[model samples]
Target: MVLPALMLFVAVVLIPLAMTVLLSFNDWGQYKGIEQVFILKNWREIWEDDYFLEMFLRTFRIAVLATLITALLGAPEAYILNRMQGRWKGFFLLVILGPLLISVVARTLGWALLFGGANGVVNKALMSLGVIGAPIPFMFTETGVVVALAHVMMPFMVLSVWAALQRVDPQIENAAMSLGAGHATILRRIVLPQIMPGILSGAIIVFSLSASAFATPSIIGGRRLKVAATLAYDEFLNTLNWPLGAAVAVLLLVALVLIVVGSNALIERRYAEVFR
Candidate 1:
């Protein structure tokens, strides 16, 4: 049973990935079929272009910031939820999980309205508060992009962090308290250390998701900030450059692989240290 499923997964995921790697090295353009010989132009071009580096830097920065900010926001929420019992717990889970069920298009549209220029709720509220003399630049800027991406990626981090938090035996906390540890000391010495793995796992998910996100950044970033995913989308879909686009896709995939592998190793090391 599992063999068939595993085979199917390999067929779908690994096969395309292998195909993309082959495509990235070839110049399969509109003028040519898969007949073209392999070339390093795509990789070379990406490396030489300063703007490309900026786009990648911006993307990396945005993803990092969004993951950190959302983790901060979600960790407390997850902790609170994990502590609760009964109907309230289920209801709260429903609330957190509700957004996952909603279409990404729908969520993006909602944020667009709030962040719309001038008459928008966000701009209007800020203006009323006299925080700025003019509507602060948003909806196409890095700040707006980060804000939107954080909301979209929050749930993954929250659940992971919560699971980590819940796994820390209650006895450890009680023992900390019994040993004359302050609230802050208990949190720092015991609770925080135990939950570190969960937080790292959440950050890994959040980072990967945001890094690969195209829609939210496209709609909310509004063409101003181009993340790596959108660049691939434009190259493959818009320009009909399969080879170049596939190359970009492969790049994104490689980045994801590296981050996940490195982060998991770090998590494992921390787990060993903490458990030892």
Candidate 2:
């Protein structure tokens, strides 16, 4: 079973990634050859491009926001779930994780329905309440992208925190309480310290997912709020510049790797110190 899965990763992920990294440096076209030789030109072009810069910044910002939101909401829910018994906890876990099992298109479309154009459900409610004269622009905007990505990434955070919370010995919390630690003190000083590893792991996972998401931003934010993923999509699909798209794709991968490494290092250090 594991062998099959590992081979799939090499096929679907590893080989393609290696190719992308190579293509990012060299000029690879459909029919073109060495005339368009390898250099730093592709990287230079990306760095100088306004669209690339804007979209890169927006993607990073949106990813951070979504990751943080998921961590904040997921941690508490996971903690609460950890305290639940029997099938109720399992049932709630299913409820939280269910949306992730659905297609990105379906989830983003659901948001679009609630926030699409002037006649969206959310707009209608806002208008009826006289909160605004016009529909609040939700779809095709950064706000929309962040909201949808956060929702999509919530499961990653919840599952991580749940695992961490499970590993925590209840006796530690009981001992803290017996030592006259108040509820808030117990949570802040004891509970949070123990669960920090889980929270950090979940946050990093959420960050990477949001940063790499293509469909969520494209459908929910439309073509207006282009993220790094959408930018890569346009480069390859719309402009037919496979080399540029591959470059952008490589950059995305590098960004994810760096974030993952940095987050893990920081969290591991903190985890070590707290437990010590």
Task: List the candidate 1 regions with Cα displacement exceeding 4 Å.
Answer: 28-35, 129-134
Query: What CA root-mean-square deviation does each model show from the true structure?
Result: 2.1, 3.0
Encode model 2's per-residue lDDT on 113-152: one tens digit a residue.
Answer: 8887889898899899999998778888888788888888
Deviation from native of the Cα of residue 48 in model 1, angstroms: 1.4
Model 2 C-alpha RMSD vs. true structure (Å) is: 3.0
> How many clashes (backbone atoms < 3 Å, residues ≥3 apart in a chain or on different chains) does model 2 have?
0
- Candidate maximizing lDDT: 2
Note the clash tally of each candidate: 0, 0
Clashing pairs in 1: none
Candidate 1, position 64, lDDT: 97
TM per candidate comes to 0.91, 0.87
As for candidate 2, its clashing pairs are: none
